[model samples]
Target: MNPPADADSPARQIDARIAALGDWRGETLARMRALVHEAGPEVIETVKWGGVPVWEHAGILCTGETYKAVVKLTFARGAALDDPTGLFNASLEGNTRRAIDIREGETPDADAFKALVRAAAALNASKRKPARR
Candidate 1:
């Protein structure tokens, strides 16, 4: 049988996932949240697909999750990003996804993360162009 979705599902999932990290997970998630908020005021936090914490300004900009040894940052439109920092991880079929896999207890590149957020915001905003009159 399938389970029903709940409002706090995302938060619960986040807590559970972070808890699996044993320690430092809270700090990492906190930093990730700050990064998204600092990116722009329009960035809204929501419980999106797969019960994940999604940051959306124009669309799904990024997701925060804690792994056993790292925190995962997934950008929805990452493939289209310029990503000069080479911070993406190559997934299946040589596909590079715009993401930063920060170590569970390590400090991330704040400047780089901010830059990526700005870039993502720009990209998402541009997609909202008005129709011709």
Candidate 2:
């Protein structure tokens, strides 16, 4: 029998989750994780809402999750930014929600993703939230 996976290892956790999923979606998610880490070595992986791995620096920047046959990359403040490359899709109408859905064998545009990440970091850094009481 194989030993249980470690929760501390993000890759392992993701792998286990992917194994459970058993689909192309899982593979796409794993690839997306690699891309995020590659884009920013300073990027920290935190388990936020629903045990999803959220990558951020100053504030909630982005979250990646597996969907049916695709990996969804969500940018929190995507609507506020200018997307001339047409890389983002409106996840919701009239809201800040935006996502890019990529499938297996489809190499995500690394440059575009990096650009979005940088933009997100800048936006998060520039914002002034209410001071904690």
Q: Of the candidates shown, which would achieve the greatest lDDT relative to the real structure?
A: 2
The worst-scoring run of ten residues by lDDT in candidate 2 lies at 1-10
Report the C-alpha lDDT of model 1 over 1-133, residue by residue, as the tens digit: 1113653654455555555656676678767777767867667667666656787887788888656677788887888788777666534133544677777556767877887888888988898767689
Q: What tens-digit string does per-residue lDDT give for candidate 2 at 5-99?
A: 66666555556776777777777776677777676766766666766768776776778787666678888888877676887864846578688
Q: Can you give the TM-score per candidate against the true fold?
A: 0.73, 0.76
* Per-residue lDDT of 96 in model 2: 80
Question: By TM-score, who's the top model here?
Answer: 2
Clashing pairs for model 2 are: none
Error of 2 at 87 (Å): 1.2
With a 3 Å backbone cut-off (N, CA, C), the pairs that clash in candidate 1 are: none
